[model samples]
Structures are given as structure tokens and as C-alpha cells.
Target: MATFTKANADYLRNTLQEAVVKCSERCLYQSAKWAAELSVSLPTLPSVSSSFDADTDSQMQDVDPPPISPAFHFANNDPEEARLEAQDLSRYLLAKSYFDCREYDRCAAVFIPSALPRGPLSPTSPNSNRRTPTKAGKGKGKDSGVITEVGSEPPSNALPKLSQRALFLALYSKYMSGEKRKDEESEMILGPADGGSTVNKELVGITRSLEGWFADREARGLSGSNQGWLEYLYGIVLAKGKTEEDAKRWFIRSVHLFPFNWGAWLELSELLNNVEELQKVVPELPQNLMTLIFHLYASQELYQSTDPIHKELDELENIFPDSQFLKTQRALLYYHSKDFDEAETIFSALLHADPHRIDSLDFYSNILYVMSARPKLAFLAQVATATDKFRPETCCVVGNYYSLKSEHEKAVVYFRRALTLDRNFLSAWTLMGHEYVEMKNTHAAIESYRRAVDVNRKDYRAWYGLGQTYEVLEMHLYALFYYQRAASLRPYDPKMWQAVGSCYDKVDRPVQSIKTYKRALVAGTYYDQGSSFGSGTTAGEPTGVLDPETLYQIALMYEKLNQLDDAASYMEMTLAQEEGPEEDDDDEAGGHGIGVTTTTSKARMWLARWEFRRGAHVRAMELANELCQDGVEVEEAKALIRDMRARMESGRSPS
Candidate 1:
């Protein structure tokens, strides 16, 4: 009996410690294991025989006096308090096991023996039945579940003083269980697709109940040491409902006190949409090893790099040596920089090591499409299909194959198929928009781009596509809004600036147009110094405005303002800049590359016409004769010369 009491007390201590330190999947397993090991009823002392001799009974009273409860010992100065604590610990064991094993419905049922199928009982409230859990330990017992009726109820006169640690675990388990069930329901709605996100009314109500509990506890000064975790949970719900700042505060508070909670860090990271927002909250977070790791992880998700993050990657490698995940990030950074040549070697080595890994295979397909390497894309598609025929990534690759072949309809079909499998596969929406544009289905294209933006506001591809579609439809106002949005997201991309400038011109805002075009000329300086802009700088927007289209556009805008001198200077500047990103190209993803927009002869011709209209007859004649000598724009040059000489021969003042 003494041994049993000590063992049970030790079990109680271990459970509480584990609950406080790490009570998610690991706790669930430990609790489940305990339940299996201690499945029998609590040990009881044998009743004293009624037929003992008078002397023996007298001696028994002296030698072996009636024992205190054998397997329910607790360290409380008050015997009653110890007994109550011990009883509560015993009663909650089975339910904790059920919850840890993800038998949530059963977990709740066992929470209160008196209340069937209605708990994860409150430690403070006699009736509240809220519970939560992280998503894990999916398997449930098949038969003879660890417990049916875990234990008898405690006396009503004195309620069991359940440990706060045990109660929190049960609450978290149910939360996780709620998410798991929601996913299952979503998966069933449209075969593979989640039809939409539905509010989990159950979780919302639980959170509402806990709010009052937290308030009451604080009022009474009974809110325990574990309150930080509760705040973290509350923040998660707040974020889901878009109480933006409130969620950040709660997460900040939780992590400041409990820096190792990875989920809280991740939640906080997701709430911050940009560097400015992230920096605002960083100082408030704990300066610890886990927080350091969080920074390394979160930076990749938040920023669109103007340079490769390989330096950060290398720093992280000091801690996570030879990490596969780090290698993948390095490869992705190269891909982002559009440095396919630099990325190619790393990707080849990765593929050679793990031929079936689909981590960056979709990107590989996109690169192939850009290069017009049709055969290579086909081979990639086959490998992706073999790996997982129904995967969204595979569908994206197949879609790219059809796109490269100019089968726009086939490409759209596959892209749509990818969406059906996973609506949040952001690239599918953008890719589908591209195909719709090819098919001249403007309305469909608009809808696809809008959906992509809804999924992720950082998706510059979708924003740019929407701008282009609006421009095509002559909706310059709407086009300008999206172009500006894309430009804000990718500030160093001259193409985005150019789009914004050109849209301003369409709307007859020549001053703004000229200003924006000039910004594009100096956009490269804004990129990180000595970084990998070489590969990532999309062809037309090469590190600087190498193609000089921006200069030409600035000159055109100046002409619109009737500023002939500025226009002539900009036109001369255009000759000083050349080649890129060929002038004929549209956006990189969907261009035919047969463009002639920025030929030197075209700029010269425009400059000559503008000079002549401004009454500079001598300069116009000089430009016209030069173009005619080279046979470049000869017909237009001759026509210009005829008009110039006619004006001179007629002897009227040139306009």
C-alpha cells in the first residue's frame, strides 16, 4: 500500500510537469500510454474481517490502524485538500488519455462521469465543457477503449480540485480535434476541394466561454501561471476573425513569456504581411534561440527578395548543418532571382539525389516553359505525374506543358483541374488567367486574377496580370490601381514601374507618367547592393533600364506636355541606352517575344517628328536625311523630307 501510494503520487507529478512543459502530441501519447498501463480500478484496502477475536481486534487497532486512501496521496497541509486533489487527478487520467490519443468525443464523455458525451470539463466552472487540441495522433482505439466509465463522480458537497495543467491539455486537444474534423468535412464537400471556409461555431462558442472564465479568474486573482498559453490560444481565434492588432498583442505577450511555442511564432509571422509590420513586433518578442529560428523561417515567407538570401541561408546553416530544407531555400532563392544558370547546378544535384522529390518541380516546369525547352518540361511532367497524379503541383506542370504547346484550352483545363484539387494553389489562378488571356476570355481572366489576389495579396503575378487585362479593356483607372499595387510589392522591378507610368499616360496624367518612367530608369539602384540581381532581374527590367524603353516613354510623356527641349534630351538619352529584355517582349510568363517597340530607328523617327512640329525645321531635315541614308525608316524619312522642303519652298513660317 505504501509503495502503491508513492507510485501514484509520482505519476501525478510527472503528468503535471509534462502538461506544463509540452502538452500537445507528445503529451497525448504519454497520457494514452499511462491509461493503458493503469487500466484496472484504483487499488483499495481489504476490508477488516468482522470475526476477529476480541483481543486480536483490540491489538489490530493498536498495530494496523485504518489506512488513509492507498493510491491517492497528495502534498497538502489540509488532509481534505490533499484528498480532493488526489481524487481529481485520478478521475481526469482516463479523459486525458482519450484526448491525447485524439478520441475527442470520448475524451469529453470521460471528462465528467456524470455528464455523458458533454465535456472537457472546466477546472473552475462546474458545468463548462470546452476542450481543444493540436492536430496529431490520428489513430483511435478499435475495441475496449482505454475507458468507458473512467471513474465515479466526486462528492457534490466538495468538488474535485482538478489540476489547471490537465484542464489546459484537454482544452487544447479539443481545439485540434475541431480543426481535424473541419478538414475532413471540407475534403468531402467537392471531392478534393474545400468548398469554402466555414466558421467553426463550436470553437467560437468555446472561446467566448473562456473569455468570461479568464476575466473572472483575473478578477479573483486566481488566474494561474499557465495564463500565457490561454492568451496564445485566444490570439489564434482573434487572428482568424481578423482582429489584426489584438491578435498580434496576444501573440506577442504569449511568446514574450513562452518563447518556445512554435505555433504562436508561426501565427504571429502570418499576421505580419510585410517587413515594416514584422519589424514593429520583433523587439517585443523574446530574444531567444527559438525566436532566432523563427526569424530565419519567417523572413523567407514575408519578403520578395531583390537579392538572393543565400547569406542568411549560410548563417542558418551554422545552426542547422547540411539541412535539406536550407538547401531547398537556397535553390528557391536562385529561382526567384531568375538566375537559372546559377540555380541549375544545385537543382540537378538535388534531383539526382532524390529524383521523385516534388519540392521545386513546379518551378522547374515554369523555367522550362520560359526557355521553350518543351521536351524537358514533358519529361518533368511525367515524373511529377508518376509521383502523384492528382497533386496540384503535377497539374501545374502538365498545364505548363500544354501552355508551351499553345494548347490554351488544354492548359486552362489542367489549371482548373489543379484549382479543384486545391483552390489555394495560388499559381494555378495566375496561370489560368494567362491561358484565359490567350483565349480572349477577358471576363474569365479577370475572375481568375481576382481569386489569386484573394488567396495571397503578395502574389505580384496575379496583380500584374489583372493590370494588363484592365489595360487591354481600356479601363485605365482600374489598370492604374493594380499596376501601382504590383509596383509597391516589387519596388525594384522596372517593368512594374513602366506599367504604372504607361497607365498614367493612358489616363492623360503626363506629369505623373514622366515622373514614374524616370523612377524606372533608376530602379536598379534600389535593389540590394552586390546581390544576385543578375539572374532574378527579369529580362526587360535588367538591373537598370538597359533597354531604354523607359527613356523613350519618358520622352513621349514630355512631348504630351509640349516640353520639346526635355523630350529631345530624353530621346538623345534613349540612344545612350540599349538592349535587354528585348523591346518586343511582354511580361516574361506569357510573351511571344516577337516585339520591336524600342528599336533605335523608332525613337529617332519620333524625335524628328516632334522637333519638326515644334518648328525646328533644320534639325528635322538633318534627322530625316540621316535615317534615309541608312535606309532605316526610309519611306517615313522621305515623307518627312518632302514636307520639310515643301514648307521651305512655300516660304510659310514652319509650325
Candidate 2:
């Protein structure tokens, strides 16, 4: 819930680790083990004091120590050689702790100057020999677990002192305690440090701090034309700050000065891994600005990374804790991060800020999308309805979002709303047609799709949609006509070709259907600039049997020719594929090959019918009875049974 703002604050906290390790000899030795233990316990919310003995100020006495290297012997007087190996170990521990706690700004703040001190350079006066300790620690810690800062000293020619490991542990605790030590320090420091020397190299290293300068300027309503600030920022980024602070400051300033400057925003955001700030800043700019911002954000969000924007946000919060725009900014951040909960929290705040706040609509819609918050969508609908009720596009978009979720009735309501607002909203009419089709209201779907085509002859989807609805309704002629038109618009889509084949089959045109299917196969390969393969299948071959609908057509062809056996086989195949096996195949197949038996039964039924037609009563009776009992062809067999029984009962020539 806490917010960070200023670059310097964020920088200092981020660099605290490096600062702590530089403090004392005793801390330099013990901080590593202490820091490692603390890191493991942190996620469990362990009490900080219990994780390490905060009060241990005495030197640690070990059972065995490593032998001193030849470099550490009195034989070497080089400052670098005399440097204890223990110092490097201590710095590593302190830095690790600061990083874990997300106090990156502090870590950088401490690390930059302590590890690499710069001669103090005032903006107004140039100097050569002077160095400024802008913000320095007080003394080394003697208190239990507390880091006492040794007072600020002149810039030394020797290697800069690294903080003791315990120092960072102390700083982190101070930060969590809600202490305002840093803020108090910032207020007391009136101007640049008293160093007269220009240390451009190290000064350029503090990125986050410089970024904060620009953030501050924007917050104060100062525009980007401030040349002095611009030059300073460009310098830091140009050098690529040695600490995160240098980078952070440069980016923040650049973004704040030119909110519409997507290049600057992107570079800065990328470094901090914070996109939320850009999200907030985008809507605040002009339409052109928002457009550029959208393109940039969308492009960058495409790349995957786990770095949380919350770190940058924390820094932003600390700097502008009381800004009225903070809520909107926070909400935008949450939305981009896909954190709907936090986004909603900030959106609620924005609404409180202004019930009619325009950005709230977008924020609410985004949350709805992210969280599947349908109720929030309804709320968005209400808001749009209450405001610009005559915006057809608005209503259409709202409707489409609902339709995607399969709320057809609700979708229709919005689609109708859009139609009422703009009589010529062809897309809305088309969408309404689709919604009706989803509800199985074919008549309505047809009318709506027709209206869409009538409004815009080139609306291919609308034409295709109409053809589909007609096909479902068994209007093959009409389906064919619409499908042809749709195919002409998007000639490469194999689906359109397939639909054309289906319509041809429905009209009892097998040759045409086969031709259409062949065309579909060709189109499947090169159509729509898409993959040629069938759904869920590979590209090697177009496998699988003919579609059920096609099989039905084949059966019809056999029936027209009086080929009962062939017709039955095809029909059985269709049924088998559609509803699975449900009938006795033994009767149909007649104890033979499935194909041969079907033909044999056809021949037997024909002979029995012929015999009954003649007046030879004995023959008719015997053959008909035999055929009827066989039961291979149910319809034909039943007919023979009726004829034979009637002939016997009549007793007059019995045939």
C-alpha cells in the first residue's frame, strides 16, 4: 500500500546493501552468514530481529581461519593488495539483502557514492578539485543490530569504503518501521554538495535519481523545455549509470518531461520493469500520444518477463504520496500487470475523485476482461448508456464483448441498442444475426445477416453467416447463392469452398459436389494465406472418410436407381458414422462379405417379388414366405409377406 516517488529515495534504498557493507571491520566479517539466514526467513514473514542477532557488535571468534595470502603479508604495500578479501564478501551480503526487500533505490543510492565517490559538482559553478558527499551516513552502529553511520569524510584517493553487512540489515529494518529518516535528510539538504570538482563519470551513474528529477518537474507542472534538467538526464543515460539509481532517475525525468515520448518511456519502463506508469501517463496525454503509447506498450508487453512493476511503483508512490492522480496511475499499472484486484481498487478511487471520470470506463472494462467480471461489464454498459447513448460503435463493442462470452440475449440487446443509435451500423446488424443464430433462431439470423449484406455488399462474414443459416434451414438454393458471393470476396478460404460443396450435395448434384470438394482441397492448400492442414490434423494427407452429409447424398443416388442393396449400405454407413452402430448387421449382410451380402439380398427380394406377381400360387407362396422369413431387407421382406398372406386368405388363384 505504500507508494514511492522521488528518484533519490528509490535510489538510496536500492543501494543500501552496498552502503551497509562498507561501514565496519566487525560487520564486514559477520554480515554474510547473517544475511543468508535472513533471506530464507523473509518469505515466511519471520521477525527481522529473530532472524539475526541485531545487537551483536563484538568481533566474531572463529575456530579456524583461512591462512593469510602472500598479498596480505607486509611484503606488499600496494593499496589493492592490502585490501582484505573479507570486504568483498561483506558487500555481497548487504547488496543481496537490499535487493531481496525491493529497496533498489536505496541500494543504488548507497552503492554509487560509497563504491565510487564523485567530486562535488554544482550546477551553477564548475569546479575541478572539490568533491561533495551529497547525502552521507552519520556513524558506525554500536547499538544491537543497528547500523551506526560513521560521519561523512572527504573523498579519499583510496578505494571507497564498502558498508558492513549489518548496516544494510539495519537500514532495511528502519525502512519497514515507517521511519522518515531519508525524507528528513532530503529536506535539510538545500543544494548540491560542497565539492567543487566535476565528477561527470560517477554523477552519470545514478539513473533512478535523475529520472525522479523529471518526475518531479512534471508533478510540479513544469514542461520538458527545461534544458538544464534535460542535459543532466541525457548525460546519465548516455553513460549508462553504474547503479540502478542513475538509470532510474534518467528515465523518470525523460518520461515526465515528455509524457508523449514513447521512446523515453519505453526505455525507462523497461529498466524498472514497470509499465503501469506508462499506462497512467498515456491517457493523460493527447490522442496522438495515446496511440503511440498503445503501440509501444503492446509491442513491449509481447516479450515475457517476471520482473514486477511493483518495484517501480513503490518508488513512484514514495515520491508522490499525496498526488490526486496517484490512484489513476496505480489503477493503470494494475491493469497492465493483469492485476485486476489492484486495478479495481484504484479505479474505485478515481470514481471517487470524479464520478464522471472518463478514464474510469476503460479501467472498468479492462478489469472486466482480466477478471471475467461480467457484472463489471454490465456496469460499463450502464455507464455508456448513461453517457453517450447514441454512440453505435460503443454499443457494438460492448455487445461484441458479451457475445464472445456466449450471452446471446444480452448481446442482442446491445446490438439492437447500436442499431437504434445508428441505422446504418452494418456490423451491428451482422453481429445481431450471429447472436440469433447462436440462439437457433434461424429466421431472425437470416434477416439480420441479409440486412448486413444489403448495407455493405463486401461484408464477407455477413454473407457467409447468412449462407450458413440458410443451409441449416435446408434452403440449399439460397445457401448456394450466398456462399458463392462470400467465396468471391475471400476466394482463398477453404471453408467457403466446403460450404459450397455442401450446398451442391443438398441439391442432388454429386458430380458438382465432388468438383467443389476438389476445389476445396486445392484452396485448403493456398487459401487465406493460412495453414493448409485440416483442423487438428497434420499436412501429410487429407485423411478421414467422406463427411456424413456427403454420404447421405450418395445413398440418395443409389435409391433413385432402384438399387436397394447399395442404397441400404450407404445409408447404414451414414448412420454408423453419425449415431454409431445401433442395428443388426447380420441380417443386412446375410452371412457373407458385408458388400456381397447386401447385393445378394437385393437379388433375392427381386426374385420373390417376381414370383408373387405371376399366378403360380405354389411357387409364389414358397418363394415369398422364404423371402419374408430371411429378413435381410426389412421393407422388401415385409411387402412380400403381405402379398403371400393375402393370396392364401383369398383362396382364389392365391397369387
Candidate 3:
């Protein structure tokens, strides 16, 4: 047996005390193991005493020992008993560390034995007969003395509340890992766990254990910080199980109590979509982390101007003067701000520093493509394809460059390769759909868009693509369904509303078409008002100059509904749009004559016929004469003229 010497006792006491004070789980386990191996009784650490000097006392006032949890207490003074207690504590700590690192199987193995009661063994103990007979003896059956029936035995050791909690967490981790693997294989975004039977059991166990812990801590009036940590973990579990709102409430409560919890801050930022809110609590976070949050905000396009992003980047640069990551982020901010030239300059420097930076490569390719720098884009794509062929983003960039060049077949190959590398690459899926649409493969386009939606249902682009594909196939019902879904997801998008309105018209629902077109006009008006230049329309105009095509469609729908007055009103609006300042030069020729000249001719002839029917002889004659000036409508105008002249010559009142 090992002797418990004074020196060993002192070393164990100091190490354990320090471990407890630092809250270092790994160090605690090591110290506990050393004490058990040496059979040393740990001495109680002395209480911190105030210094006699007033100045020193004030400085040392906050140096008191950390409070120990009840689970960490040793009830015996006997050396042998203390050694056993230390061994148990070491097991607990080991189990906790494994759990924290997400090694669930190891965590479960260590925790089950440490937590459950262990009974003393007799001659017929389960451990004694644990070994099975060899395979050769299997054919001999019971006569060969092979162990068969394994009976359950009661545990001698009582389970601790903390151990029970750890056990539940281990099981929960295992369940979540399984779900994550499934999501990866299926190319779905990682989100809340599906309610599988096994997962539900684990969730129930975790919830029960957590509730008990909360109850116990509250009853004992424990430290609020510890309770806050509990809440944070509870929030994580709830979030994994798809209870987002519930999880958000818990995260808010956690940060309120423990303001320094960075994990809580990050989760809250995502839930609220407001990184600025986190600054109120964690003002002194590391510059790298702060820059990352700002980058995330920029990526989400949350800021209308670059002022706020530039300010944050400037502050970060001041703190981390030589940080390459911050420099890359600054370039990204420039790109988001639409300063393409400045962004290109910064990205060029970054790529020069590290030629293989994937993010820089991705963003630079996109910038060059947007700028119509075709030669540079092709060069970058070629170099990236040669060097980083396996990277999904590289493949995607190459695919995009080819797609821009109208090389649809070659682009499809690279896009498919990107998807093979990362099935949930939403951009790849969407780009592939565009390629298929360009190739005139409506079926393939629909499939690609469907896959995109399967990966992320909230992807409005995917829904809109599906709607377009269906509309092209003349599947009005299907088009209407997807267009409605897309509109719901992005109600501010006028294009989606227009698509819905067109689908209604195709299905012969003129009233619904009118309503949908009106909705589109309202959305367009708001969009223009919110923009600096009215999105290519006259600033501050009512309805903000709706798409000429949309206006024509609305007029046609009104004609179908036999509301000729409204139809004429809308036709006049359409003709006026063609003569607006933004009119294309091609309108002078008949090449792009879908606007004023052609549409107005048709509208005028229809209006004349309607006026003649309504006994408005003068108005009908004037409209007919205007139509007669155009050779294309001369015969129709002459026929209308003859009818109006005959009606007037009868001298029977215009009707």
C-alpha cells in the first residue's frame, strides 16, 4: 500500500485546490488520479485571510476561493476512504471531459459505472461468469459449461445527481450526431432533429434531468452564473430539437445573467439577425470574433450603406493591425458596398499574399464576372481549375464563368462536380438549374430547382425558378402554386407577384389576374420608393412605372372582363410608358415594338369598335381616323369608318 506522506498530501492539496479554482476539468481529473494512486488524503485549503496592510487588503479582497459544488465534497477523513472518493471523482471528471468533447460512447462507458450503484460480488458474481465459451464449444450446447443466462444485479454504489445529468447529455449527443450524419448524406441543411423514436427518448431523458437540476439549484439558491450556464446548455438542446422560440427565450435569459458568455451572444445574434445588439453586452470581445460577426452581418446584406461596416472594420484594423483575415473581410465589405474597383484591388493583394485562399478566389471570380471582365474571369477560372480542382467553390466559379460565356454543356459538368463534392451547395444547385433552363431542358430545370428546395425550403430563388419552369411548360396550376409560395417568401419582390398574375391570366381567371396585377403594382411602387433612383422608373410617381409588359397584360385582362373603360385606361398608361424617358432607341423601328406604337394601335382600334357600339359616333370616328394613318391598320379603320358613316347617314340617332 502507498504511504500518505506530508509532502504528497501538500502537493495533492495544492494541485486540487488550483484545479478547482481554475475550473479546469482536465487538471482536476489528473490531480484526483494522483491523489488516489498515492493513497493521500487531500487537505482542506485554508480560507483566504485579509492582509493587515489596508492597501494590500483592498487589492486581495477579490481573491477568495471559488465555491465548490456539493458533488465535489468528500465526507470522510480516513485516508483509505479519501482515496476511494478521489478515484470516484476522477472517473466523474473523465466522463465529463469525454462528454464535452462529444465522445459519447466513451462518455457513456465511463459514466454508467461511476454513476450506478455497485454491489459486492459473491462466488456466483456476474463478473466471475462474464466470459463466454469458445466458438468450438457452441455445438456442444449446455453440456459444454458455456455461460448463457446473464442476470441483472443491483448496483452497490448510489447514482449522483451530477452523474445522472452527464449521462443524459452523453445520450443526447449521440442522438444528435446520428441526425447530423443523415442530414449530410441527404444534402439537407442542418437544423432541428426529426422526431425519431430513439431521439425522442433521449430528448425526454435530457429534459427531465435538466428540469431536476434547475429545481435543485433554485431551491438551494445557487449562484446565478451557474444557473445561467445551465440555461445556455438547455437552450442548445432545445434548439437541436427544433424548439427555436423556446431556445431563444432561454438564450436571452442566459446572456442577461452571464454577459461574458460568447456562445450565448453568437446564438442570440443569429436569432435576432442583429449583431449590433451583442455589442451592448460583450463590448470587449476579441477583435477576430468581433470582425467575424461584422462579416456575417455584411454577408447577410443587413446594412443599407457601408458606413457601419466600415466603422467596425476600421476599429478592428486599429486593434489587429496586421490581421490578414480582417483585410479579407474589408474587401468583402467593399464588394457588398458595390465598390467593385476598390474590392478588386484589395482582393488582388490578398490573393497575391496567399494565392490559394478559397474565399478570396470565390469573391474575386464573382467580382470579375459582374464587371464583365471576361478575359480576367476566364484566366482566373483556368488557373483555379488547374490548381484547386477538388474545391467545390473553385468548381462553382469555373462553372459560373462558363455559364456566363454561354457554354451551358461545359458549365453543367463543373456544376455537377461541385454538387458531388457538397450536395447542399445551394448556389451550385441554383446555377445548374439556370444552365438547364438555358439549354431548354424544362424537365431538368424543374428537377434541379426541386433539389434546391429539398435542401432548403426557404430558398426563394429555388421556388421562383420552379415557378418559371412550370409556367414555360404551360402548367398554369403548378406555376401558380410555386409562384404563390415564392411570393409568400419574398413579398417585396414584384417579379414574383407578376408571375402569379400571369399564371392567373393563363388559367382564365381575369378577376384574380387583376387583383394579382394590382398587388404587383403596389409592390413595385414601394420598391421604387425605397430605392435611390426609383429602380429605373420616374421618381415619386404613383405605381412607379410598372413593367410595360405587365401593364399590357393588365389591359388585356380588363378587356377579357368586358371592362372596356378600364382596359382603355390601362392601355393609355402602357402607351405613355413607352414614350417615357427610359424608352429604348429600338422602339423607333418595329424590331422591339411591343410598346406604345404597336400596342396603342391595337388598343385604339378596339376602343373605336367599342365606342361605335356604345353610340359615341364622334369619338369612334376620331379614333378610326387616327388608326387609318398607319398602313397596317388601314383596312380595319376603313371598315369602322364605313360602319360609323352608315349609322350616321341613317339619321336614327348615333345608336
Highest-TM-score candidate: 1
Per-residue lDDT of candidate 3, residues 402-495 (tens digit): 8768799998998888877776576678778878988999977888888787656656667888988898888999999999988776565567
Arrange candidates by lDDT, highest first: which order?
1, 3, 2
Residues 249-334, model 1: lDDT tens digits: 77887776555455677678777767687667777776643455466556666544434345556644543343455566666666
Q: Give the better candidate number (1 or 2) by TM-score.
A: 1
Q: What RMSD value applies to candidate 3?
A: 16.8
- Give the alpha carbon lDDT tens digit for every residue of 532-603 in model 2: 111212122222333344444455555556665665565555534423333466655222112223444554
Question: Candidate 1: minimum summed lDDT over ten consecutive residues — where?
Answer: 141-150
Q: How well does candidate 3 score on lDDT at residue 21?
A: 31
With candidate 3 superimposed using the best TM-score fit, by how many Å does residue 334's alpha carbon deviate from the native? 11
lDDT against the true structure, per candidate, is: 0.61, 0.47, 0.58
Name the better of 1 and 3 by TM-score: 1
Alpha-carbon TM-score of each model against the true structure: 0.67, 0.27, 0.53
Q: Candidate 2 — worst ten consecutive residues by lDDT sum?
A: 51-60
- Top model number, lDDT: 1
